[model samples]
Target chain A: MEIFDILLTASFWAAAVRIASPLIFATLGELICERAGVLNLGIEGIMVIGAFSGWMAVYLGAPLWAGVGVAMLAGMLFGLLHATLTVPFGLSQHVVGLGVTLLASAVAYFAYRLSLPEVTSPPKIVPFQPVEIPGLSQIPLIGPAFFNQTPLTYLAFVLIAVVSIVLYRTPLGLALRAAGENPASVEAQGLSVTAIRMGAVIVGSGLMAVGGAFLTMSAFSSFFFEMVNGRGWICIALVVFGAWRPGKAALGALLFAAFDALQVRLQQTPLGALVPYQVFLMVPYILSILALVLMSRRAEVPAALMVPFNKGER
Target chain B: MRLEPIPNPSALRSIGLPAGALVLTVIVASALALLAGANPFATLGLILKGAAGSKFALLETLNRATPLIFTGLAIAVAFRAKLWNIGAEAQLYAGAIVTALLGTGILPLPSALLIPVIALAAMLAGALILLGPVLLKTRLGVDEVVTTLLFNFIMLLFVSYLLEGPMKDPMGMGWPKSPALEKAARLPRIVDGLRLHWGFALALLSAVAVWVIQTRTTLGYEIRAVGLNAEAARFAGIPVGRVMVKTALLSGGLAALAGFSEVAGLKGNLTLDLSPGFGYTGIIVAMLALLNPLGVVVSAIFVAGVFVGADSMSRAAGVPTYIADILMATALLTMVLALKLTRTRIRWR
Candidate 1:
């Protein structure tokens, strides 16, 4: 292959990975939550809150890592709120999730506005620079495409493996899955279903918040309103598409990211020049529908995905 | 200790449920405002002043409420049939797109004929947009929530495409807006110089129409029965599937009116961000109304007041308009929790 062609292809792949980072993080988080029988619909809102908090922290002279920490703390707080409503209060999971999304969006918007008057130009936080592995950087096409990426991208890939191992290879994983599948049976076996589910929800929300923070800190230097957009919902779809498996969920994210990347690339192509840019933008959503239809016929969702579990219920 | 039986509750007690919920939401939202360093009472006073204190503000509030009332009713209608129609936002856009095309096209009709024709086009467009999800859900057992939500993105993109390409105004100087609708195709205003147009009346009529259908018709009974318990309705020989399909389509059509009203009655041109989450806000409106048709009108107006007030509050208090949204969400959450508390508890056993 020509050098120029190789460079173009490598850049495309790089963009794809960068786009997939947030999705991957969120999907893995959702996988854990779903495995424990709690459906965290507040993922989108949590991500938005994370983006704002992270941006605010970094914009105020805190380290970028500190932003991540603040984002995770915000996510944990939201997760606790959601857990209280759905788990203990036994409110509708779907309604509570929607409410949380609304509340989160409102908080982010207000916070952004409150800070707007003080700064003439929005403060730009430095993004995480690419860290190249010494020996891996010299490898073939894969080296530049995978190893020479931001720290968050590599963290996403590592998380997929870590989550997969934790979900399928450990006793805790078994107990969590059992809690979702049959909380009564799990409780009878001397496990605390509420505790397990709460842990999963908090962890999932924290991971999603980190994903949101990445959007503001790495992908875009300054946070815009609704920066997370619908990526959180996309993560929800990915969990279903991947059938609650971490590795498969990561693949789903990659697939979505690839399409999104292609859409962006197409905007520069001759064919894209003829059509409206909106059509290309719609490609991801259209593909999502097609994927949903295809998956619904074959994919078996968790047996107790949205159903609230009670301790004594058999 | 033995307890005596309680006395009969008054009418106020019954109405107090929703009223109390609304009050509680405001209190919580006010606390949040305090955290933001703004006085909740002062902020709310500004909102009230902006929404209803003056004629112009009231007109703006009505204009905002016009579409919300339609979308809220649309949501409530589908909810009554036990169908989760989250695609109202997309469906509204679909209606707006069709209305824009027809209203701006070279069809030379008088004002009387053009207006109705455009409105019908919007209704049909909305209904058509929702058909895919309706079919998938009723025939294939696909979840409408995901499909509807997904379609919202598609329709939004489609709208963006139209504005950027074929529908882009030639004289817009690179701005992404459609050409203004011909005067004949525009909705006439009832009052001069105010934003309030005939769409408010149309929305009112539609709300009444839905109320009549929901209360006086056999179809409404079937819908209510299905919503209460689908299997039981099916066992009772009610065609639950048909009711779901019809209700979903009706919901889409109603939501479409919101878009049509915005384009024909307000903007007179299609813009990219025509709705700032009006579709999503409709969900809160519907829930706050407890899915009651008449209640939807009152709830929609109240919500609209908040939005109008928020814009002014943002300007005056230097707070983000999103504080209004936070308040709205808090109100909705409280309302839902309160409703759940008042309902008969179900025992899984």
Candidate 2:
């Protein structure tokens, strides 16, 4: 139709892509972790840690890349703590993960408050700038949509591709998959199942942290309490919907992000104009339940998703 | 380390696991406190002083404990039936929504009648919220954890809608909260000026009621049996599905009481932040109590003391209130780990 109409549609899609980027990274990370037979329910907490660390890094003199680095490190530390609790200690994965989430949220809130003690107004940071590819910018709709995004968005797409290859195309991937499927069998073959799972957890947490950092450093510059909100849990649901596949999980994240973006855009529409905003806020959760119901039968989650592996067990 | 076969402990001895875990957690948590530039012993002293130091602080501690007792009992009852009810937070909100609706409405009744009716409405609201997951888990074989958790978000959104939409008071400025409940519908303060109200008594009474049902009643035995071993329980002619459904509903109802207490007893108005994660904290309480109803009261007060101490710690130590949250979480983590590590196996024929 008209140029303005085309621009509006493009802008909406762009916003959708931006919103979905962190989710895509986090879900893919969770997908890898789940495939390796660990349910990193601490994704929410790790994400919050990432959000805070990233914000702190940016608040200092660090660049956006530095913030991402710090976020990933923070995520790894959290993942290490979570893995130790559930893996060696054999504590309830759900309980430990939930605890981590609460602890991380508390840490983030306190850090934020400490950094901006005197300010009644919300603290702000400079968000990452979009980097446009030189030749790609010349293309029509595809150019703006794909090439013009923050570096993290580009990295997120690359990660999906990388994760897919690492999970299905390599010997390490095969061994990791086997470990998750039957730890006893893998252990008999002389592979350390605990080590493999711990590696997966750490890597997955790092990815989740990067996702959180993306939210703070790119999507939203300012950190608020509960900013990560329930996105981490949403990422867990995404892994289920994607059936623990990196590509599919990324798609699920994008779908959720698109719906979220549409909800925001629809707030300006006539139907949305009449409805209370909270109804739209419920869309992600409602869609998550619908996704679970529709996919439960077909979704082939890892057989030992939450089960603790004991080396001494036969 | 030498491999040795240690003597298997008696069941009575196994109960010491929680106590041992608490001591270990305190040690580890103390180390963390040192890293924060605070003395662990001093911090412990400060926490105790902050929680129980002043009359006002003690009253605040009781107020905090009031809702937690209900939530803890709610969690314990569900855990007894092997039902993991993570939606206590949502149920709490559901109860609060109903209490607000009924308490603010034009129901011409005496204060005595109005208050109990409003409380009952809250209980029903909370119970009704659990129906979906209970049905889904039993009928469709869906995981209650996912369904209950999802429903929590739905209920939260619903409450937000009510606060911003139909329940919004016209006389209020731009605050996103409902109109204050009628004076007749409010819970009477137990002591003249203290924030303590009849809800505290209700909390204590409910704790006793839960203990009676859990230990003395047949249903409680069935619930405990199902939790221990569902297949064996079913083989023993216990209605496992029915027990699950009932426990889930009861858990929601208990959690809802916390919401009722907040609205009618404390706030007299429904706000979005009515619960400061009371449902989640209830999980920690239930676990710490080892799922004992009476023990829930002790654990809840302990947890409430932490919250009160956290606020005071912020004021006294200049440490953020979140330090207390961190310490509490650390304690929970360590305690859970310790319990698992110290699991005493029983040799029985």
Candidate 3:
């Protein structure tokens, strides 16, 4: 059978969408942060904290969405730490973000060990299931792929519209974008650049946590170590690949996810027998680098990215 | 509030602020211990005892520190030039792969001669890995942080492929590990009958080497010039791009030496878990040391001691070992803040 035949299957597209859901949420989150002139490298560990706390909350008898809320709150708390240092304190975003990642990840592990001291295996919970839309489920392949997903997945799709609209059509969005591109201009307009950037990071981090919670609450039924597995970093690359635009970033997520899903399917075909599975796993990362190189020439990165802004100073 | 640079910071402000950061870290550590229902003082004591209270513990800490020193030096060298090479983890592994390949009965030489040849080869391999990302950054304007990070994932998968395929230890019972190094290829112990190897000695030598290079060379001046201001450095007739390329090779080679040392000196075989995020932790070490080459040695030992101490403390105290990681992260954050504060005064409007 031809390799292209795998792409025709409804199941393949379904897997692609399911995988893309988490990336969509995260890329959008990072997008928002970068749009506000802050690069939150804390995304990786924030996701881990989110995955653990969200699942831990659900395991302790909280409602599913409430578990997501717990995850978001946990992420925001870390985001607060990140913003306090990088935003107001005017510290290096790279160092502070890495520190937050380590701190958050360590907190998650410590919390996990303290919470469930006896469980040898990760306990399972009731994960989100496919909720089919009545009319769209009957359409062709795209319908089942896009419409019949968990509520979180649907929310992820909806957020792209929300973020794009708010970023483009709203005054708040203008100020936020101005903070990234020209903070002096933002300062001239009588808006607090720090507040805008901090709010963006905090809210954006909450969304990133939800993306992580999607992994445990929707993708898998249990939480485990390294389960997030650098997905957070991949989402960062997605932000660049999409040029920090919400709609384009989500598309980048989908494109990468499709390639990921394809690799999985490729591993089961005749080609699977010939090559090592590790090679296939390497493709997504290599492709991310390639995407960065391809789009970097035209990529409109936020001018004030990684630039610490101090009040009354350039 | 606004931060203004101080023309001359007093001695007390410099020392006191950094000391305050350490005190804050201790308080945080104690709080974490209390949360785990352990006696905070006892837990802290146990950590100290576990790290340096015994000769065995001290050696173990030194062993763990060997890799960190290399990676920390790697970061310090690159970061001093404002070149962010996050792929040190991958570069370290590249060095390890070279070590595994050359040391597994492939190279025919005396132990003394073979080690240097393998180290040089490993450094070259690691240097080449970083070269790609630096080139992409210089020419294509791709962000090296993301590209280097992406390279880490790619490199790990490549290592997994090798361990499971050509490098697989045939004598091992189906585990993914490389063949053991030949007796001639392994590093000799620093002292007879001691677990400590010559890698620790080599690390010290490298640190001093890096110190001399940074302080006494024209390349060093150019690196500092570029890091301070690229535009100014270019105007001063220093080749900014070429210096970055050279720095990349030096940094990547240093990071690769960690991998080489780990396989050839400590583990004697290459495995999937050769490093426990030594590359990432190196960032914390380098930052804590303020990117000083000599300071990297001190910070690497401190970071390694924390891990070793915390691991030992976990057995005695009800607290988890993650407290060490939290402490490290806290120290990194607080130290950077302290450093910033030392140079600048915060004034409230």
Best by TM-score: 3
Question: Can you tell me which runs of candidate 1 are displaced by over 4 Å?
Answer: A1-8, A118-121, A310-314, B1-20, B192-194, B344-349
Report the C-alpha lDDT of model 1 over A133-199, residue by residue, as the tens digit.
8888667767777888888888899999988888789988888888778787777887777788888
| Candidate 3 residue runs with Cα over 4 Å from true position | none
Superposed by TM-score, candidate 3 places the C-alpha of residue A174 at a distance from the truth, in angstroms, of: 0.4
Q: In candidate 2, what are the lDDT values of residues A1-314, reduced to their tens digit?
A: 23235346767677778988999989988887888888877888889999999888888879878888999999999889888887766677877887887777777776766666667766778898899999996577767777889988999999989999998999889878887788888778888888888899899999999999888899988777778878887888788788878888889888888788777777777667789888889999888877777677788868888878876654
How high is the DockQ of candidate 1?
0.45
TM-score of chain A of each: 0.95, 0.95, 0.98
Local accuracy of candidate 3 as per-residue lDDT tens digits, B14-121: 999999999999999999999999998999999999999999999999999999999999999999999998889999999999999999887778887999999999
Native interface contact recovery, model 1 = 0.65
Q: Tell me the spans in candidate 2 whose CA falls farther than 4 Å from its real position.
A: A1-8, B1-7, B10-43, B235-237, B344-349
Deviation of model 3 at B43, angstroms? 0.7
Give candidate 2's error at residue B243 in angstroms: 2.1
* TM-score of predicted structure 3: 0.99
- Please report the candidate that would top lDDT against the real structure: 3
